[model samples]
Every structure is written in C-alpha cells, then in structure tokens.
Target: MRDLLGRPADTATLSVTDVDAVLGEVAATTGSGSASRRSELLSDLLSRATAGEQDFLLRLLTGELRQGALEGVMIEAIASATDVPADLVRRAVMFSGDLATTAAAAAAGGQEALLAFGLELGRPVRPMLASPADSLDQAVDGIAEPIVEYKMDGARIQVHRDGDEVHVYTRTLREITRHAAELADLVRGLPCTSVVLDGETLALTDDGRPRPFQETMARFGSTREEQVRALLLRPYFFDCLHLDGTDLLDVPLRSRREALHRVAGEHVIPGEMAPADAAALLESSLDAGHEGVMVKDPDTPYAAGRRGRAWLKVKPSHTLDLVVLAAEWGHGRRTGYLSNLHLGARDPDGGEPIMVGKTFKGLTDELLAWQTRRFPELERGSDDWTVHLRPELVVEIELDGAQTSTRYPGGVALRFARVVRYRPDKDPAEADTIEDVRAMLRG
Candidate 1:
C-alpha cells in the first residue's frame, strides 16, 4: 500500500464493489499465470484506494481486523436480518459448515431454505463437541443410561466417503485428504458404500501406545511419502453420522453406535453401553495410555458445533506447585492485565528455577487484576512483551500430563497446564522440582 498510495491525502474513492471485483479476480487467478495477474489486480486496487482504505485492506488481508462482532453476535444479526429464528440459523450454519452460505440461504427462502441444509456427502459437517466434567459420577448423574467411551488424545477427524472417493477433514473443517491418503484408503475399505464418520487419529508406537500429541500433529504438516510412512496415523472412529445413503444427524446415540459398530468394526473406539463399572472403564482408558473417558447420554441426538451437556469428558488432572518466573502482557479484554504466566519448576540442585511451560488458562477477573498489581511489585527486569519477576511466588498448576520437550531447559513441558490458585503458604524452595515434572513422562 505504501508503494502504490504513497502519502495520498485524497478522500476515499473506492467502493465495496470495486474492492470485491479485484478480490474476485485475485481468487480466480491460478496456475503459472497467477503471480503477474494477481500483482496487476493488487496494483489497480491500491491505485484507487485512499490511505484509510489501504489501511483497512491491509488489516483485512492479514487477519488483524478486530471488530467486536463474534460468531454468536453474527448469528443473532443474521437471524434478525432474515427474520428467522436464531436456533434455525445456527443449526443451518452447523450442518452447512459455512455461515455465509447459511445467511444467504436464509435470505433467499427463509426457514424453508435453512431447513433444506442436511448432511451432505463430501462436504464436512461440524463435528459434535463434549463439555468438560469434573468426574464420571457427576457427568452421568442425571442421565438414565450413559454411554462411556475412551477419549483419545489426538487430532479430531471427520471422514466422508462417497463410493470410492474419500475425504478427511480436521475439526476446523480444513481438507487434509492429500496428507491422509492412508486414512482415506481405510475409509474406502469400510463395508458401507458411503459414510461420514467422526473420530480421532494419532500416531502409535510399535507396542500400540499412542505417541505424544506433537508427534501426531507432525504427520499433518508434511506430504513427503517417506515422512508420512515413517509416522503412520491410525484412526479410531467413535461416531457414524451417515451410513450408506441414510443421514444419522438426528439419530440417537444408541442407534448411531449400532451404525458405527456395523460399519467401523475393529476401527471403532472401545466403549461399554450403560456400563455397570464406569470408573473401571476410566481407569482402563488411562492405563492404556489414552486420555480419559467421554460419558454421553444415550438418547441425545448428535448436536454438531454445540458444547452441550449431552456429552461430558472426565479426565483426572495432576496439580503441582511451581514458581512464577515471568508474565506477558495480555491482549483484547485483558489489555492491561499481566497474564500468560511463565511457570518454572524448582531446581533440586539449587540453581535458578528451570522453565517448563507457560499458561494463561483458568484465571478469573479477580485473579487477573491481582496479578497485574502484584507482579509489578516483584518485577526484576522488563522487555517489550514480558515482565521478568523474582521467583518469590508459587502457584498451583493443574495439567493433564507432561511431554518431552527440547524447547525448555527442564527437557519436559506441561500439557494443558492451567492456574489452580496462588500458593501463598508455600515457599519457592518448597515448590515441585523439575524431576517431579519429568516423572509424568515415565508414566
């Protein structure tokens, strides 16, 4: 923008239509002719844009445009604009997997158009989500018959197969079929002619133990055949949304499990229906090197894109008292607060606290305010983003587990670490040592 518009003080002359046309041309330009054509289109766009327009374009292109409107707000706006129920629009967006498409459908034909959206083969539908539960008993307290399944700590996958052609997508609906050809081939070998299955995929060791989360994620980043073969991912499907030609979006859990069992066979995740021993199942899952268990209501329909109480995830969290080394300045709603704590484990050899990991989760408004005021008092030095503080404060941190990491001096990092509370009674010398944190990897 600076190259083309160079200190132009002229009033804004570009309209939305003008910018949209250039963007359309840029989107359509492809193959060997794309670079020069896209450059020309961008040059033309900047020539007509004012300084303010150029600034807006830059932010929009770079995804730094931070208006206050979120997805929920946009759903409400769409409902109001189309004179349709918010629930209907949200459901449509969930199934269609595109908010813009849902809004256009609602505008074109109202409720009828929104209702027309269904589970389409080859098009990814938003996967259902589970809410966190403190314990297994609490998760199944009100439910009559709970279906508990092992919750794998891996990447979420939504696989769709239409005859021989198969496609796999991530939880965010990004197509990864090229990188997941082995998974696609396995889907093609399923008994059904066509299906949509929701599951998790992860790399495993020779003994079938799941690898670290980072190793599983590394398989998704490369397309080299040798690399893909070196770290093969195995799929463990838990839900069957579409089987053969019938759509099971509105099917109950019991019926969906039957379908999943019929088509998935050995690929199905291990679970028991209305287990008399839910706690035993959870223990077995953890013992098998899996995450935890997902307790689900048997009668509830699969509600995609919604984190309702129909499904609840229970995992035993491990907590440790660690020293606070530093903190980073917060952003957005936490603009002035000192958030994102730099957690460190005490060195048994009496050296400086060894950095393990950092976290900003589980902090309330009161905690944020207290940290902002308190950290500055103990600050030893400062940088543009981080405030280095004296290792005088100890905080209790809850984590899922620890993994081997080369990023920190401790050689291990916390996974899903969150603040439990500040340990005012514990001295820094009494904090959990780096050896204690690394012990999680052994188990």
Candidate 2:
C-alpha cells in the first residue's frame, strides 16, 4: 500500500475498524492538549495504517470526503440496497428518527423491521414542515377545508416526556433540556404521561404580546440560569406526535391536533377551521404580530422532515430569508468592518446552506457596526480577506431576481440582493429553501 505513495512499507495493513478506533481516540482528546501530543497521536496511527487507509483517514479528519451524498441520496441507496419500497423507507426514517439506523435494520430484517419502526418516548421525531404558498387562496386552492394557525416567528421545539423525566429538542434534534428547564416544568404539568409534543417556544412581553425574536433567541441560547429566568418561554404546541403509549405520527392532523388540545390544554396554538375568510385570518395573524399563517389540511398525515403541499405557509412578502455564510472585510470609510455579506439559501435535503450571492448594499452605519461586532462572535474560520460564520444568523433578503448560475451550489444567483433585516426569531431551518429561490427564477 505504501509503494503507491512512493514510500517504503513500514507497517502492517490497517482495517477500516482500526482507522475508526484512531478517530475515536482523537475525538476524545481535549482541545487544550498540546499540539505535539496531537501530532504524535496522528503519527502513531499513520504508522500502523496502509497508504489507502492513511489517505482516507486524512480526508475524513479534514472533512474533505466530498462524498456528495446526503440523506436523500442515502434513502435512495437504502431502498436499492434493501429492496424496500422508497416511500416505505422514507416513512420509516420519519418515524425511527435516524436514517442510518433504519437502513441497517432494513438490510438486516427486511420490510418487517422497517414497518416495526414507531415513535419512541424521549426520542425526538422530526417535525413536519410546511411548503411556501405565494398567496392565501393558493394555499387553500385544493383542500375542501383547512386549518389556519398563526405562524409565530420563533424557535421550533419538540418536547418528549416519559413520566417525570422530560427532554426537549430543537427542530435540528439538538437536546436543549438543560437550557429549557422552565419549559420542561410546564410539560411536566401536562395531562398525559409519556407524550411527545411538537411546538414553538418564544418569549412574551409584559403585556402578553410576543417579544422580539432576538430576545427569544437570547433566552433560548442561554446556558446560565439567570439569563433563562429573565425570559421565561411559553410553548404553543401544534401537534402531538405521541401520547400515553400511542403513536400519532401516522394519524391524521385532526386527531393529532385533538391530542394536542387535550395534552396542552390552553397552551395549544390558536386556530380555527377555515374561517369565513382566509385573507382575514392571515391579516389577523400578521396584526397579532406573527410572520404569517400556516394553512394545513386536517386529513393529511404528518410528513416528518418533509415539506409538502399538504401544509402551506402564507406570508406577505416574496422575500427569501437566508443565512449569512461569510463576509469580506470592508474598504474606504467602512474600513475594518465586515462589509460584503455572503448569503446562502437553505438546502432542502438538510445539508449546509448553499452560497447564492454576495451583497454590500442596504447597510446603515448602525448595521455595519453591529455586523463588525457580531461577525467575530459567529466566526468559524477566516482568512485575511473574509470571515466565515457558523450559518446561525438568518437575514431577510430582497432581490431583484435570481438567475441560473454555475458558480453557486444551488445553480442560481440572486440579482441585486440587499438585506431587508436580520431575522433573530427564525432558525436556519426556517430559512427560505433553494427550491423557493429557484422557483422565483421562472417568475
């Protein structure tokens, strides 16, 4: 193996398992450890690995595998590998909450194993998502009747409770229980035992109106008790995924919503059967300080992790809310400030945001100062010219239009993109999708 790299063979061949073991050891080491120690550890592992193993290990460690395979690709691969129906496999993943585990079970135990997958208490099932609707009428165009609920701009939360023990997860499946003890306490007081709830959590002002999205995020991201105590969150559960040993994932939205009402009581999100006027309901939601209304079909089963037309989100503007991926250093009077912002659209397949365009317009001196101060805090890595961020901040962008572009990962670029405002209330998950941006190209 070493001969291929023009190096003399020095050690025995290493199996894939051996490489994994080394990676585990490296991952366990603290960042505070000496650089020499890390180098020595890697050297030892490399000495025992074959050339092919060494090459693969380096790429894995450097995150340059570039396999170009995402969950969607894996689902297709699993379907092909296990001879299982693709939709069945997708549905299993939706329930099981892990594609890798579902694929393994399907390969080992076949269709029965896939069918056996169900909602488990304390495991967060992916929240069902909504597709964007251009207008209220477009949203309710086909369905006989739909339920329109206020789409509050806030964090997506999935609360799982079994008896006295409770766990809270974000839409991305990150456990935030330690940070949301107040929310857990509220869940504990619920009527049912062993339940899974899907909801939105946000802070409210003293007058009982929703607070600014930034204030909600400050409390959501806080780890200190004082910070959390200062801003108590209220969870408005919209759907019940599981309750009292019964899984409601495959059940119609109407039944699940009934379960939500029974479990969450008054805390359930406010909604009514297609009100006499969908437009009025949308305006009411907006006037009540919400982003929009989610018009959902009651008979449709929850399609977790998938955005479908069964549920439609109606908002006022056609603007895309994107994440700030990176920013270049400013020039002239704006010197030392991070000026040109690199914007990206959310990938629908649950991957990193795809870079769409760069914009330097629509900035006031105040915004520039804020970006200069905040960009450093969100920095992932940086070169002399630009600073890359963690893709945590979502910004609303007003674009002249989008055009086909081979330069961007989404195969499209924004024309004359300008920042509308920073969306402190929305997560990257709620950002406008690549499909949403591309759809604008044709219009």
Candidate 3:
C-alpha cells in the first residue's frame, strides 16, 4: 500500500513501475506460502484496503490489465521491496493460479513444486499465443502447416458442461454464464456427457449474417433486457475442445474440425481444411461485403491461451496504421485534456500526412496520461487540444471491417474504423497503402 501511493519518504522517489513491482512481489511471496495462510493474508489485506485499492491489488497481482500495470513494472517494485529476482517472481506466478499462492510458493517451495501445476482444475493452462497479422500474405505463408480461417467476430467463448451443470467463459476467462442463459439451454441438447467447445458469440444482422461488432458490444450494456432479447446472438463454433470427457485440444485441426462439424452443425462457422489460395478467399470475402476470414493451421491443436502464426485473420481492405496527432477533451472520468485523437498517416504519394479521423474508444484513464506525457514530445504543434505531431507511430485499425466514405482527402473516408493499438516499431512509411484503401472503398 505504501509502495502504491509512495507514502513514505524514500518511497516517493520510486516510479510508478517501482510501485507495481513491490505489490507483485508481495502477492508472489504469499502465493509461495501455504494456500490457507496466503488466502487469509489476502483476505486481511483486502479488508483493510478500499474497494478501489482491492481492485488495484487484484490487477497488480494477476497478470491482467497490462496497459499500465505491466508485469515488468510489477516485478521491479516487488523485487526492490522484497529483494527477490523478478524472474523468480514470474516463475512463481506461472506455478500458482492466484498471486497469493504464487508469492507464498516462491518464498517457501522451489520450482519443482511449481512445475507440477501443468493441469489446473483438471484442465491444463497453456501459454496462449496471440493471433498473427491479419493479412493475406501472412495467411498464405502459414498454408504449409494446414491453415483454416473463420470470421473474426466479436466474442470468443468457451462452454463447459458436466451433466446438468454448465459454465461459460469469455475470452479473458471471466465467468459470464449468467449473462447468456439462452446459450446454456442451447448447449444442453448437444450430444455429449461432458463437453467443452470454443466458438464466438455474435449478434446477427436481420439477414442472418453476423452484425457489426459495435452492435454486439452495445447489446451487452443495454439496460433494457427486452432490447437485448431482441438482439439475437448465435454461437458460431469453430473448434471443439472436450467431447464427453476426452480433451480434443490435443487433436489435429483436421480431426477437431471433423468432430466440430459433426456436432456443431449449422452452429459451426465453417472453415475449409484445405489451404485454399489466400487471394481467392480475400476476393470472395470482399465481394460478400463481410469482414475478412481467419486462416488456421489444420494440423495445429487448439492453442488455448496462445495467439500464434497458427491462425491468421485476413481483414477486408481499407485500414491503416495512422499516428495519433491530436486529441479532444472527454467527459465524465476524462473531464479535461485529450481524450479523443485526430489520427494521421504518411502522405499517399508523399508530401504531408493527411488527416484520417478521430477516435476516443480505446484509451483508459492511465493510458490517457501516458499519452498526454509522451505525445507532447512528439507533438509538432497544436491547433487547439488537437496537437499535431510528426508522423511516427502507426496503429492497426479495423472498420465495419469495410466501409466507404467521401468526407476525407484521398476522395474517400473510413466507415467505422477505430484504433486497435499503436504500432511503435512500425515506420510511418509502412503505414497502409492507398491501394488497400481503394479496395476497402470498393465495398
């Protein structure tokens, strides 16, 4: 707590990262101890802290919420305060399900006990790889490994059922079983004693295709339950994990696809096992006016936690790696300062960067300050709160995932594209080509 707020004399010198590290180490130390003892310690600590502090502690301890509270920062703070190597702290975390146990175990037992946590809750917890670049070339290169691609829709869900009981988890592994009771009844009819299936839940358009991601997100927060009911969400199964008591994640994509196709039927968003030509698929998708397809390696097993080259999504044309040049003030939590951004990209033919659009959706409070501090250094100048900058950073953006507009230069504008993340490593010259933007406009 002292470290988080930097309460004491010397602690004030500690940076934000230093504070994060201190908290993580405490969590890891407790994780390395007896489970009961660690739990009690966590309970006590949690009780004394305000609800906000508890949330911060949870974010610090768990490896989640990395934008501000990164693992490196957390490790540094803990190591400095507890005098432990950051690596040991990381190893301890991988061993224990929770930080309290991880801290205690690292402090008490060695890696031998830590390595025994291969199977968690009778289901294994593996390092999940992130999805590779959502580009055609990337998908084609992965074809040697038998790739299959599906629609990159909104929600990724995992459904687990043992007899009458059922549990549904979101992509982040949060239990959201209560949020979608309709899905439970749908899963009940499946032909298995116990099963785990991985798929996406999407809001469908009136014509039966999946609706835009915006509609899907908005449906979740609607206070009118009737409105939510009116918005139909169907599960499009792409992979099968557990059939009966057998875990299919180890099975090859072909075997899993066969099993998934057989059981999931129309519910499964079909992906061909054949590694078809990427350009052909891209053309078909663009013509259909739908988001791009996901290319998956047919031989690859279900990578539970990993996003790797095993799967690649090919999005529709008309996206860019634009730099955030300026921002406007926000309301509510962000009362003043740049909350929204005016994005820019390198000149289409080479000159000055043209204004792309503005977005306020992706940034969090902590991220806002981080940007507020960092952007000024890059800032070329400012008109108002909309500060202009030298085009340096690039962001991977997505639209409806294809839409046309005539509001901007280039004789076109983006439909509903928004920031995914800032690509610091990518050079501005490498921002999306104008040809790609034209392809997007065709739709």
List, residue by residue over 1-443, the lDDT tens digit for candidate 3: 32233222322233456555544554676444556655555555555455555555566566533344455466556555555666555544542435556555544554444444432332323233346464667666736654455564567777777887777767656666676777777877777667777787877767666665656656555667887787767887877776766767667877888887777788887456564565676566555445667777777765433345776666644457775656665544565556787766567688766666667766766778877777778877776546676677677776653333356665545556666777878887888754455555332
Give the range where candidate 3 is weakest over 10 consecutive residues by summed lDDT. Answer: 3-12
Each model's C-alpha lDDT? 0.89, 0.83, 0.62
Q: Which candidate number maximizes lDDT?
A: 1
- Assess candidate 2 and give its TM-score to the true structure: 0.66
For candidate 1, the TM-score is 0.87
Please write out the lDDT profile of model 1 over residues 1-443, one tens digit for every residue.
34544454377888898888899889999999798888788877876677767776876776865555788789999999999999899889889998889988998999999999888898998778888898888998998889999988889999999999999999999999988888999999999899999999998888888988888887888878888888898999999999999998788989999999999999999898889999999999999899899998889888765558888999987999999999999865677889999999999999999999999999999999999999999999999899999999999999989999999988999998999999999999999999999988723
The TM-score values for the models, in the order shown, are 0.87, 0.66, 0.58
| Runs with alpha carbons beyond 4 Å of true place in candidate 2 | 1-59, 62-67, 318-443
Best by TM-score: 1
Candidate 2: 10-residue stretch with minimal lDDT: 1-10
Question: Which residue pairs come into collision in candidate 1?
Answer: none
Off by over 4 Å in 3: 1-130, 134-137, 275-279, 286-289, 304-307, 320-341, 344-443
Instruction: Report the Cα lDDT for residue 333, model 3.
Output: 56
Of candidates 2 and 1, the better by TM-score:
1
Q: Which has the better lDDT: candidate 1, or candidate 2?
A: 1
